[model samples]
Target: MSLHPMCGVFVLLSICLISFTTPCYGGNILVFPVDGSHWINMKVLVEELHARGHNITVVRSSNSWYIAEKSPLYTSFTVQIKENLEEFFGKYLKNHLKMEREGASALTFLKLTKDFISMVSEGHFLWCEAISEIFDDPNRVKSLIDAQYDLVLTDPAVSAGVVLAKYLKLPLVLNVRWIPSGEGHFAVAPSPLSYIPVPGSGLTDKMDFMQRIKNLFFHSIIVLQQKFVVGPHYNALCDKYIEGGCDVFSLLQEADIWLFRSDFVFDFPRPTMPNIVYIGGFQCKPAQPLPADLEQFVQSAGEHGVIIMTLGTLVNALPAEVAEEIASVFAKMPQKVIWRHKGERPSTLGNNTLIVDWMPQKDLLGHPQTKVFVAHGGTNGVQEAIYHGVPVLGIPLFFDQYDNLLRLQERGAGKIILLADVNSQTFEQALKEVLHQESYRQNIERLSRLHRDQPIAPMDRAVFWVEYVMRHKGAPHLCTEAYKMPWYSYYCVDVMVFLLSAAAVLLLSTLAIFRFLCCSRKRKTKDKQH
Candidate 1:
C-alpha cells in the first residue's frame, strides 16, 4: 500500500530530526580560570560546554568554589591562597588612582609597564603556588592524571594554567578576555606595530609617522620586557611545579586554539590565524525586566531619560574630587543619574541623582529611556553598551581600558575624558555632547545592528568550535605555518640579508672591473707616449 503524501513528509521530517539530534560522545575537559573577572567572563562558555554533555572540571578559588558546585555536571577543585588577591588589587587600584591624580604626564609607558609587571607577577606567583600545592598531594596528582582529560582550557593571563596543561600533557586552549596584546603577538600571526597599536598606546590604526614611531617604540619595549623579565619569572614558577620546564612563551605560541573576547568590529584590522576565533559578545544576553524600584526611578525622568554611570567592580569608586565634580555636573542635567558608588555619597549630589552600590548595567543600557553610559572603558562594559545601542562617555582608568576607549572614539560611538583632566566643566560639557548629539546615537545604533547581524549566535559558534577542537583531537591542521617558523625566519630577515649580500658583491665586482679598464687605458696611453 502507498503512503499518503503528508505521511511521507512526516516520515522524512522524522528521519532528519533523528539524524540532527543524535548525540555524539563528549570528551573530558579541564579548565583553569584565574580568579575574579577572568573566571566570571569564562563561566558562560564553561557552563555551555557542561550542558553539552562534556565531563568538565574547574579549578578555582575557595571563595568562588560554590559557583562550580551549583552545577551537577561540573567537578570543582578549590585552592586556598594565604594572601587575599582582592587586597592586592585594592592596593593596586589605590596606587593607580594616585598616579592618575598626580597627572597623565606621570603615567609614562615604562612606569605603566613596571606597574603591570609587578601586579601580574605577584598574582602569578600566588596562583602558581596555589596550583603547586594542589599537586604536592600525591593522591590528587594521581587522580588528575587518571582522569585523562581530552583538553585543557585556560586563561593565558595566568601562566599557572599553562603549567597545569603541561603537567596533564593535554592539548591547550586559551580563552582570553581581551584583544591580543603584545604577549599575544608572539602566539598568533604577526601583527606589524606600524598599524596595529600596542594595547595601551591609545593610538589608532591611522597613525602618522611620529605616532607610528611612538607605537613601535612602546611595542618593542613591552615585547622585550615580557621575554627578558616576565617570561623567566613565570618559567621558574612553572618549573617548581611541573615535571618538565614550562616556558610560557613557547606554550602560548603552541596553543591549539585562541578564543578572543573581542571582534574586529570593535578592534583594529590586523592579521590573524585560523585557530584564532572571535566571540566578542558571547557574554551578552537579552536584557531582563528592571526591578520595580529602578523602573519607577527611570520612569520619573519623563522625556529627559536616565544616565547610568559605573566603573565596573574593580574600580568601585573614583577619586573623591572627581566624584564630586561628576555629581555637580549630573545635578544640572535634565537626565536622571544612577551612579554605582562604593564610597561616601558625594556632597555635591543633587536630587536628580541616585547613588547605588550596584546596578544591572546591561538591563539599564537596554532601556529606551536610558540615554548614556559613563564607564571605565572595560571590554565587557563597552561591548554591553554597543550591544544595547548606548553611546558611552568613557573615563578610562588603566590597561586595555585606554585602547577600548580609543576604538570607541574612532568609531564615533563614544567620547573619552581623561581621569586626570576631569573637572565639573569638562565632565558637564562631554556628557552634554554625548547625550544631546544625534550622531553618537546613530553611529552606535548602526554598530549595534552589525553586532547582532551575525549568522549564528556567538555563544553557539564558540561552543561549536570548542567541540570541533575536541572531536578532531586538537585540530592541529588549523595552526598557521608562522607558528612553526623562528622569529627571524617568520619576518624574512634571512632572505633579506642574503639578497642584500648578493647585491653588494655584484656592485663591488662591477666597480672593480671599471677601475681595471681605466688603468689599462691609462697604461696604453703611456706606452704610446713612450
Candidate 2:
C-alpha cells in the first residue's frame, strides 16, 4: 500500500529521533572562534553536524568587555572615564568605531593614527581575555570535559582553548588563519615566522642565526605580553587560569592537526608539520543571484567592464597619500571602477567610476562585467576572485599580502603592484593588462575549476575530521606523539638519519687514516734512504 505524504513525514521524523537519540559515533564537539567572522564557517559546520544527529557546543565571548550597559552606569563618572580612555586607544578606537557606524570623522582619526596603533588595543585584549576566562575556568573546563566531548576545534588566536584541550586529553584541529610557525622564518610574531623560506627550507631555514635571533625577539614580545598583561588579567579572572608559561612554539607543537586556510596556490615551499592540511579556498562556494540594483551597476559598466578595488577588512581605509593615489587611479580609468572605500568619497571620483564605502564582493566578482579585481591580495579575497574566475591586479600592503600576490602572479591569475607604486599610471596599466589579457582569464578559470573540484568542501572536510575525532574517542591515531617526547629527543634525527650520517663520518675517517699511515711510512723510508 502506498503511504500518504504525512505518514512519510512522520516516519522520517521517527527515524531522525531514533538516530539522534540512539548511540552515535562519538561525543559532543566544542568550537571556539575569536569572533563572529573567524567562527562563521565553523558555526555553519557545527549546525550541519547537529542536524546530522551529532551534538555540538559553541563557546563564544561577548563582543566587548563591560560590567553593564544600563544608563546609570553609562553616565557614571567611572564609566565615562573608561569609555573615553578606552576609545582613545582601545580596539574600539576610531577605526573599529568607523567600521560599526561608518562615520566620516572616525575614519579621519583612524587614518591619522594608523601608524601609532599598538597591538594592545583594548578590544583585542578584551575579547581574548573573555575567551580565556571561559576556557580556563576550572568549572567550565570540567563541564566541557564532563560533557565528554571527544574533540576541540579552535583558531590559533584561541591558544587558551588549546591548553584546555590538552588538559582534557581531547584531540585538536587548528583552523590556522595564519601560517603556523615556531621561532622560524615562516612564522610571524604572535607566532614565529618560521615557515617562510629563505637561506634554507622549512625548519632547516630556521638554523640561520639572524632568523633565530628575530624569532627569539618576536617570541620574547609574546612572552612579555603574556607575562605582564594576559597573565595578570587571567590570574585576576581565576587562580586556575595561571599562565602555563606556554609560548607560540608550545602551541604549535600541541596542535594535533594544523589546517591552513591558505593553499599551496599561495604558501608554497611552506615549512609544514606532518599534520598540516592545506584547505585554503575553502570559501569558494557557488554564486548567488546578484541584487537587481547591484546587477544594474555591473551592467552599466559596459563591455570594457569594471575594476573592483578593495583593501580587505583591515586596511580598506588608508592614510591620505595612499588614498589620493587610489583616487588618482580612478580619475584615469576608462572603465567603471567600483571601489570599496570605508571613508568619505574622495573628490577625484571619476564620472565613470562609482565609489561606494562597500560592495557585495562575491556578487561583484561573479558578474559578467567585472574584468579585474584590484585587491590588497588578502588570501580570502584572492580565493574569492579565483572562485569566480575573476583575475586581479593585486596591490599588496603588508604581512602575507606580498606572498599571496606573488603566488597569484606565478599561477598566471593576476598582477601585483606594490602599495608604494599604486599611482594612476601603474594602476591603469595593471588594470588594462588583467582585463584585456586572455591568459589571466584562462588561468583564473582553471584555478576556479580546481577549487570547485576538491574532494570535499573545506568546511565539510573540517567538520568530518572534527566529528571523526568525536566518534573515535579523540582519534588518538590522528594526533602527534610529539608532546610525549622531550624537545631534544623530538629534534634528534632517527636511526636511519643517524646511520646515514655515521656511515659518511666513518668513510671520511677511514680515508684520513689511510692517508696518515701512507704519509708516515713515506717519511720513514725517506729518512732510511738518506
Which candidate leads the pack in lDDT?
1
Give candidate 2 misplaced runs (Cα > 4 Å): 1-27, 36-56, 64-148, 179-248, 269-274, 482-530
Question: Which tens-of-lDDT digit does each residue in 1-530 have in candidate 2?
Answer: 99999999999999999988735464566655444345544544555566666665655432223322232211111111122233344333334433323335665657644532344334434544555555646776576667876677776553545655655667877777642222222332122345343311212223477766665565565455556644443334334443455443454455666666766544445545545666776665666777787777777877778887888765547555556767877777667878888776677767877777678888788877888888887767888888899998887655556656777787799888765566667766777788788999999899888777777787666666656555555544554665666646656757557888999999999999999999999999999999
Lowest summed lDDT window (length 10), candidate 2: 73-82
lDDT of each: 0.82, 0.61
Candidate 1 residue-wise lDDT at 152 = 88
Question: What local lDDT score does residue 25 receive in model 1, on the 0 to 100 scale?
Answer: 53
| Candidate No. with top TM-score | 1
- For residue 446, model 1's alpha carbon misses the true position, in angstroms, by 0.9
